[model samples]
Structure formats: structure tokens, C-alpha cells
Target: MKIGILTSGGDCPGLNAIIRGVCKPAIQHYGMEVWGIQSGFRGLVDDNVVPLEEKVLSGLLNSAGTVLGTSRDMPFKRRFSASSEDKPSMMMKTIKKHGFDCIVCIGGNGTQDTAYQLSKLGVNVVTIPKTIDNDVEGTDVCYGFDSAVSIATDAIDRLHSTASAHQRVMVIEVMGHNAGWIALYSGMAGGGDIILIPELGYNIHNVGSKIIERLKQGKPYSIVVVAEGIKTMENKKAAQFIAEEIEYETGFETRETVLGYIQRGGIPTAYDRNLATRMGGFAAQLIEGKQYGQMVSLNGSTIMPVPLEKIAGKARLVNEDNDLIIQGKRMGICFG
Candidate 1:
């Protein structure tokens, strides 16, 4: 059997591990020919591919990023003329020419949507969930979340000493576009006094009063962690708004730090590598069973396949009554 593989959307730390996991077993056990598609759907539409040899798969388990490259390009764009075929048709033409029995996509929500579209177009496709935000619906935890949470937690940990010495309110911004998993987990682990997420918008008065209460309790400094996707009424950045409001309300010096691309880079954590490996192997198993139009996900300790339609275009958000939020409240961590 012939199979094609691609990684799409934002790059993650465990992509290489997933590729290695998929390539080795598929080649050795299934005797399948794996083709690496470059630059996501754009490469498929353009017919840019190379064979994924076993030698190329060696020593990639610890490496970060993807070897086949990635992009956010969608295949359904109407790039051609009215009389000509659409981009998805062109991609299908390429698939037919190469005779790929199945295509494997390793990416986040958007990538899953693309795979579902392709499946609807009569292409056999499989997906593996991968996002640092941990917002994919079918999986309990995505591969890159642990690595990103570790990075964010370490950054918050390092900021504590400086914040204490200067007696300042430090506003640390983390990346979580729609979900609060990253901010919630990291804040809880890093001892953030105030945590704000997109799911539960924050109140400026409450945030300021919390800081003031901390000051009254003889705490020299406080840390506020905010998700980047959080919005203010006036469309201001959440971290900047928090800092400005607290400084004005409590007369405390405040500073904001945005951990932009730092969370997206770096080596994979051990958990991420293992998760990626398991998901990748499971994807191969789905292909072996001829289970198309499905996505491989981690459901607790078990790896399983879920329908692409069930997970595509849907985000798993943190509930207000989530155990983490409840524990945070119990531990005296305010979610403002």
C-alpha cells in the first residue's frame, strides 16, 4: 500500500516524533511506501513530494519541529478561473496521479477540517491531533500541550524572584487563542495570584481588588497570568488592560511580558514524544484497518480513532466548573 503524510498549521515540538513513529512501523510492519508531502495542502495541490526513507526517520524522536514542513493553506480555495477546476479538484488530480491509498494529516483543528473536506471529496484521509492549546475536541490532551505548559510554567517561575525583589505586579501573557488550558494549567502550577482566560472573561474591578487585598495582607508582590485570546470591552489587549487597571487602582507598579513564539518552540517533553508516538502508531493502525475519514486521539490512557466530522471545526473549551478551576479557587487563586 502507498500512503502520503503531511503536517499542517502551527508547528509543534513533537511533530518529528510523530513522523518517526508513523514512518518506521508503516514501512517495516505494513510494507507501505510513505510519501512526505511538503507545505501541507499547498504541496499536495502543487504535487511536491519526496519519499520518506527510513534513514531520514532516524534520530528524530528528540528533535523539535517537522521535517516535511507545514502551512495553513486550505484546499477548497477558488484560486482558478470560473471555467477551470478548483484547488481541491487539482489536489485530487495529484492524488490520483500518485496513487496514494491514504493520506495522514498531523495537525490541529483547522487541519482536521481540511482532512474532513478531503474525505468528503472521496479521498481516504486520517488525522492526528496536535496543538499546544489542548483545545482539540476528540482528544483529552493534545501532544504539544505538556511541552508548552512546561515552558510557560518555567517562565512564570523565573519571573517570581524579579517580581518579589521589585515589589511589582507582573502580568504574564500566554498563548491560548480560544481555550484556557494553557493559562489555567500553567497559572495553577506557577502560583499565579490572578488567572484570566478567554472562557471566563475577567472583571477589572475584581482583579484590582484582589491585588489590593494581597497588598493589605503584606505580600510584597503579585503575579497575574492572562491568556492572549482574552478580550476587554474596548478591544484592548488583556495583559495591558490588567496591568493598567491594577496600577491605577492599587498604586502598584505593574509590568507586562508576552511570551509570544517562545512557547511554540523548544524540544519536546517526554510525555509529548510518547503521546505523539502513540497517536502516530494508532493512525497507522487505522490505515491498516482501512478506517478512513477518522482521526486518532488520546482518550486517557487509551489511543483510539474518532470520526473526523466529530472533531473538525469544534474546539474543546475549559468549563467554568472544571476541576482545575475549582482547585484553583480552593487554593485561593483568583480567576478574574
Candidate 2:
């Protein structure tokens, strides 16, 4: 059997690891020919592909980013065009031209949705979820989540010494647009004094009061971890808004740090590399068994297959009753 693979959506650590996982097993164990598709679905439409042999798959387990490249292009979405260009049909032609029996899509939520669309079109499809947000549905955790959390946690840990020395409130922002997994996990792991996430709405007054209370309790410095998706007045960034509000209301010197893309780049942690390898190997297994239209997922401690339809548009979000949040509250860490 011949299989094609592509990475889609925002690039993150563990992408190359997953690709290696898929290619190595499919090439050696299953005796399947593997094709690497460049720049996600756009590559499929443009017929940009290369053969994946065992030698090219080596040394990728510790690498960051994708060797096949990635893009955010949605071929299933309608493009307002004057030309008669049907992207999905063009992708089908490419698949047939290469005689690919199945296409393995490795990406986040958007890529899963696109894979589902292709499956409905009678194309064989399998997916592996990869995202730093950890919001992909039907999975306990995505591949890049642990790596990103490690990076964010390290940043927060480093900021503590500076915050204490300067006697200031330091606000650090981590990525998470629709989910707060990164901020929540990093905040708790890094000992953030106050954690604000989109899942649990925060009030500026409450945030200010928390800093003031800390100061009154002889705690001269505080750490505030903010999710980037958190709503802020005047459309300011979450960390900047929280820092400005803390200084304005509590008269404390405040500083903001946006970790940004740094968290998404770099070699993946050992845990993430293992998770990616497991998910990718499972995807190849599913394809070998002719179980198409499925996505490789981690349920608890097990790596398994989930129907693509079930995972397409859904998201796993942090709830108010989460044990971490409850523990943070008990520890006098303000949620606001």
C-alpha cells in the first residue's frame, strides 16, 4: 500500500518526530511506500510530494518543525475566486496520480476537520493530533502540549527571581486562543501567584485586589500567568492589560512578557517525543488494517483510534471545577 502524509496548521515541536514515526514503520514493518506532502493540503492540490525512505526518516525523532513543511490553507473552505479552481477535486487528482491508498494528516483541530471532509469525499484518511493548546477533541493530550508547557513553565520559573528582586508583579502570557491548557498547566507548575484563563473569566478589579492583598501580606513580588485568549479591555494583549491594570489599581510596579512563538519552537521534550511516536505508529497501524477515516488519539494512558467525525469540530476545554484550578484557589492563587 502507498500512503501520503502532510503536516498542517501552526508548526510546533514534535511534528518531525511524528513524521518519522509514521514513515519508518510504514516503510520497514508494513512494507508500504510513503510519500511526503509539502505545506499541508495546498501541497496535495499542487502535487508537491516526495518519497519518504528509511534513511530520510532517521534523526527526526529529536528534531523540531516538519521536514515536509506545513500551511494553514483550507482546501475544503470556499475561496472567492473568478477562476474555475476546485481545490478538493485537484487534491483528489493528485492522490490518484500518485496512487496513494491513504493520506495521513498530522495537525491540530483545523487539519482534523479538513481530513474529515476528505474522508466524506470517499478518500482514505487518518490523522494525528498535534497542538500546543491541548484542545484537540477525543485526546487526553496532543503531542506538542507537553513541550510548550515545559517552555512556558521554564519562562515563568526564570521570571520569579527577577520579579522578587525588583519587588514587582510580573505578568507572563502564553499561547492559547480558544483553550487555556498552556496557561493553566504552566501557571500551576511554575507557581504563578495569579492565573487567568479564558475558561474562567477574570475581572480587572479582582486581579488588582489580589496583588494588593499579596503586598499587604508582606509578599512584595507576585507572578501572574495569563492566557493569550483572555478578553481584555481596548483589545490589548492579555499580559499587557493585566500588568497595566495591576499597576494602575495597586500602585505596584508591573512588567509583562509574551512568550509568543518561542514556546512552539525547539526540540520536543522526551514525553512529547514518545507521545508523537505512539500516535504516529498507531496511525500507520490503522491504515495497515484498512481502518480509514480514523484519528490516532491518546485516551488516558493508551494510544487508540477515534472516528474523525467525532473529533472534527469539537474541543476539550478547561472547566471551573478542574482539580488544578481548585488546588490553585486553595493555595491562595487568584484565578483573576
Candidate 3:
């Protein structure tokens, strides 16, 4: 069987590992030819492909980005270029001409939705969930979550020393889109004074009070962590607003650090590499089993396939009532 794999959506840390994982098993054990689709579906539309021999897959286990490259371009959204085609008919024609027995999609929620739409057009597709957000539904965890959380947590840890020495309020912004996993985990792990996630909208006055209370307790420094997607009444960014509010409320020097793309880059953590490896191999296994229109997912300790319909148009947001939040509350961590 000739299998095609593509990485879509925002770039993540474990993409190359997934490519290596799939190519290794599919080529050696299953005797399947692997073809890489470049730049997600846009590449597919343009017939851009590269053969994935075993040699190309080597030394990529520890790599961070996708060798096949990636883009956020979608078939339904003509956002990439003026010449972009939004129709799947062209995609179907390209798939038929290439004779891809099966195709694997490595991406997050939007990518999965596109995969489902392609499957409906009679394309044989399997998906692997990958995002730093860890918000894809029907999976316990995604591959890139560990690596991103580690980076964000490390940033927070380093910020603590500087904030202490300078006696300032440091507002660190981490990426989460709409979920609070990154903010919550990094905050808990790095001992943040306050955390703000999109799941729970925060009151500026309450946050100011907390900073003032910390100051009253003789704590000169404070560390506040927030998700990039967190919003205020006018959908403004939280970092600058929080910093200004805390400074006015406590009369302390406030600084904002946005860990933008740095969290998305760098080497994949061991956990992400292992997870991507398992997911990729499992995707190959599914293709070998003739399982189409499914997504390879992790349920507890087992790797398995889930129906595409279940994952499309759905996201797994952090549960406000989960144990993590409860523990954070118990530990006196502010989740504003």
C-alpha cells in the first residue's frame, strides 16, 4: 500500500517524530511506500510530494518541526492566497491521480475537521492529533502538550529569579488559544502568584487585590501567568492590562513577557517523542487493518483509533471542576 502523510495547522514540536514513527513502521514492517504531502492540503492541491524512504526518517526522532513543512491553510478558507482554491473537488482529483492507498493527517482540531470532510469525499484518511493546546477531544493527551508545557514552565521558573531580584510584578503570557491547560499546568508547576485562563474569566479588581495582599504580606515580588487567549470585557489582551492594573493597585514596577513562538519551537520532549511515535505507528497499524476515516488517539495507556465524526468540530477544554483546578484552588493559587 502507498500511504501519504501530511502535517497541517500550526507547527508543533513532535511533528517530525510522527513522520519518522509512521515511516519506520510502514516501510519496514508493513512494506508500505510512504509519500509526504508538503504544506498540508495546499501541497496536496499543488501536487507537491516527496518520497519518504527510511534514510529520510532517520535522526528525526529528536527533531522539533515537520520536515514536510506545514501551513494553516484550509480548503474552506481561501485565506492563504488569492489563487487559493477552496473546493475539495480539486483535492479529490489530485488524490486519485496520485493513487494514495491511504493518507494520514497530523494536525489539531481544524485539521481533523478537514480530514473528515475529505473522507466524506471518498478519500481514505487517518488522523493523528498533535497540538500544544492539548484541546483535541476524545484523547487523553496530544503529542506536543508535554514539550510546550515544559518550555512555558521553564520560562516561568526563570522569571521568578529575575522578579525576585528586581522586586517586580512579572506577567508571563503562554499560549493556550482557548484552553487553560498550559496556563494551569505552568502556573502550578512554577508556583505562579496568579493564573488567568480563558475557561475562567478573571476580574481585574480581584487580581489587583491579590497582588496588593501579597505585597502587604511582605512579599516584594509576584509572578502572574496568563493564557494568550484570555480576554477582558472588550476582548483586550490580558498581559498589558493585568500589568497596568497591578502596578496601579500596588505601586510596583510591572513587566510583561510574551513567550510567543519560543514555546512552539525547540526539541521535542521525551514524552512527546514517545507519544508521537506510538500514535504514528498506530496510524500505520490502522492503515494495515484497512481502518479508514479514523483518528489515532491515546486512551489511558492504550493507543487506538476513534471515528472521525467524533473528533470533528469538537475540542476538549479544561474542565473547570477537574482535580487540577481543585488542587490549584486548595494550594491558594489564584486562577483569575
lDDT of each: 0.90, 0.93, 0.89
C-alpha-based local distance difference test score of model 2: 0.93
Error of 1 at 278 (Å): 0.6
lDDT string for model 3 (178-273, tens) is 998989888888999899999888887788888888888999888999998888546667687778778887788999999988988988999898
Model 1, span 88-175: residue lDDT tens: 8888988999999999998888899999999998999988888899999998998799999999999999999999999999999999
lDDT winner between candidates 1 and 3: 1
Clashing pairs in 3: none
Ranking by lDDT: 2, 1, 3
Model 2 Cα lDDT, one tens digit per residue, 43-99: 998999999889998899998889999999999896538658789988999999999
Q: How many pairs in model 2 have backbone atoms within 3 A of each other, for residues 3 or more apart or on separate chains, i.e. clashes?
A: 0
The TM-score values for the models, in the order shown, are 0.97, 0.98, 0.96
Clashing pairs in 1: 202-336
